[model samples]
Target: MTASVANDDGPQGLRRGAVGFGGVLFQSITFMAPAIATALSIPLGISYAGGATPLAVILALVACLIAANSIGQLSTHLPSAGSFYTFVSHGIHPKVGFLVAWGFLLGVIVGGPFLALQMGFVVAGTLNAEWGWSNDTWWIWTVLVCVLVFALGYRGITASTRAGLVLGAFEILVFVGISVTLIFQAGSDNTLQVFGTHYANNPDYQGFSGVIAASVFTILAFIGFEQAAPIAEEAHEPRRTVPRAILVSCLAIGAFYILNTYASAVAFGPAKMIGFTADDSNPWQNILARDAWGGIGFLLVFLALVNSIIANQNAANNSSTRTMFAMGRIRLLPPEFGRLNPFGSPMLALCAQLAVSLAVALFLGFHYDPVTGFGLTATILVDIFAPMYILLNVACLMYFWRFRRDEFNVVRHGVLPILGALAFVPAFFAGAGIPAFSFITALPKPLWYAGPIAGIWMVIGVIYLIVLNGRDPDRILETKRVFDEA
Candidate 1:
């Protein structure tokens, strides 16, 4: 199980056996960043779905579970750092895999800024908690965090995953405790009222139509859970660990979201909901967090949110660095990225990712406010990820349908994959076009050109492939080496 056995002059091997099931689960779960998800996304979704936020989240979770099952099914068959990149190349078409890889890259790239901004927000709030080092310019904080995040990535997978495990546990504990306290405070109001049509007090909401509309945001929050698959090659017992991590993490995130959102809705009862969600500030801080378990509750929320952002950026970098290394090693792109450091980390690729994130964060910081920048960039991520998941589902279906027919189960291989793809239909429609299902209405006028942007991104990848093929006529066959040789 030599993960990479290139000659000394070429790519140095990645350190395998660094992440086990717990490592994958904690890293992926933190990437989901339940505290941040519940803090920001849930309230925004609640704005659309009204009091039925729990139901919208539940529907999104069901769709995510279906998609995750398909990914898990394929991880056992095509375990690699390339994740969907390797899967699609082998099962669909190698050219199509190129599109998925860069699309994924761009998506993960923006996440760094998003996570940095989140860290900045939490740090800003924590000033009153006897914390110092409050920067007037939040991008300063973004820069500082990026340095720390890159240092963590530079340390390689085991250090990053272990850090994620500790940070994730603390954040999850705070969020879960807050949820329970919020629900307990709800007392008589905590009945299954959130499941009912009791949102007349909610602003601009239209019953069931609104809840259905909000599922897009709910689904967006589930995007990070699948990052587990890309680490399959590095994880110990990846064939077993990757699939388990994907499934369990998805379920855990869903349950937490439902409980957390329910508690929020109950905590901010119908009368206060309208005024509370109307403001542009952090709703968690404005509404429930400050008063949480007393005044110091804000500190707990702040700590969890900050920890979540750091852990999430580390996890995102882990996935991106590995994917870049995978693409480079397969000869689909330049091999320099595949060349690792003495410590076995894809150091050059990690550096590239950090530089891009900083540049983009700087540009957006100057051009737009953090909220709009975050919203628009996050929409791109959601849009890009939809296709990655869709392709992986197709790859899983085809992998079983053609190559290993004996191992194929109708539901696991065929029906589940098909269902998973279908579940994302609304996401495609929401992202691509149609005025009805706009996922995030909050972003400023420079809207996310989800389909056009994705199409252009693919076109660029295809052009690169054409050039690579011209340089080495055997590029396609060489790229398929892992699929055939493995």
Candidate 2:
């Protein structure tokens, strides 16, 4: 277990101890949440281009790998609590850093609740099937899960990471079982159709636009892999382990998604898979259970869903608190936001995160359908994080340009980051468009464009910083020096 930074008074910086590679790997896997990918991803891919859905995931992974390499490089040099925000601040400009931090914070704060709602939906659905109990409001379940998350999160990162490991392992086991079963069933018929151009050549398909849109959704499965870098301060070898964990996690997630999507396509037959409608709740689970597991399918899927929700909850709790802590340390937020509990956890930050999550869950529970709520939350996530990812990709290029000249090659540092930037740029636009499109259809829109929302938040942070500077310029100067040193 790593000890948190000691604070005589004011905000305590993050602790520096030594979390082993297993802990780092466990935390990374928890952030990835394999079951969440297994449950929601296939339908999202199929809805875009049917059998070609697997290809979209593969493409997305390729793009992410490019970005991950850059991130991996950056982590080795300047491992810190703010993750991308820290990288941007150190490698680029502070204003860009502010935007990245605000953008990522907005994404995680809003996205965390959305993930909680997902957990609630899965839990409620599982319980409904098992006990014949109908919980009409997902808020009820969301609230319960939030309470558990809050308790565990307040206890500290170690507990949360351990819980994540258990849930993540179960998710992997379930996913592997389904994949093996599907592969065996497909036998010789499992061909390359799922990855071929033929699957993408449908007249009814939304074409490039659909693939772009669906890729945004598919990319969500890879979202949290980089989150482990924020807690690098707690890792045994911050430079070495952080980069290794990030690259390993991204590769593992990409491989899992591609394999699972291909397996689903094989089991259903590529042609038939394309026709599967989104109307079926938990379409991925349905496909696997109906085709692969047969007799004990429902039970197997039910258990998987439970683990998925728990894994997501653990991720949400860890990410939100660490992000808040980072923001506080940078003076973008109040010093109180940086305070840790007696147990070495960011208690206030955890509470703040939980409060926001509860508010979203409650509002959505009262006002809209679970699916609609989920859509709105997903949109917010895409809107906020897409730009941050784009920025991070750019930051990676800058980091390589400035610091790693000897190590820099066009393919690894330059070409790859450029490709990653290209890959995520359209996703940013598509995500921005989703809310507007929803409004045109007379549907309730996501809260607002997260880029603009984050912009406003940054302005507020700037205003807060100005006020802090007026009262005590030294604090601001000291913080700036810390960032410079970092």
Alpha-carbon runs more than 4 Å astray in model 1? 1-7, 125-135, 196-205, 270-276, 436-444, 448-453, 469-473, 477-486
Please give, for residues 263-344, the per-residue lDDT of candidate 2 as tens digits.
8778777766656654566755665776767747766777777677777777767767877786786566776778888767
Local error of candidate 1 at 215, Å? 1.4
Error of 1 at 416 (Å): 2.4
Report the Cα lDDT for candidate 1.
0.76
Please identify model 2 stretches exceeding 4 Å from their true place. 1-7, 129-132, 206-214, 434-486
TM-score of 1: 0.91
How many clashes would you count in candidate 2? 2
Model 1 clash tally? 0
Residue pairs with colliding backbones in model 2 are 4-15, 5-15
Candidate 2 global TM-score = 0.89
The best candidate by lDDT is 1
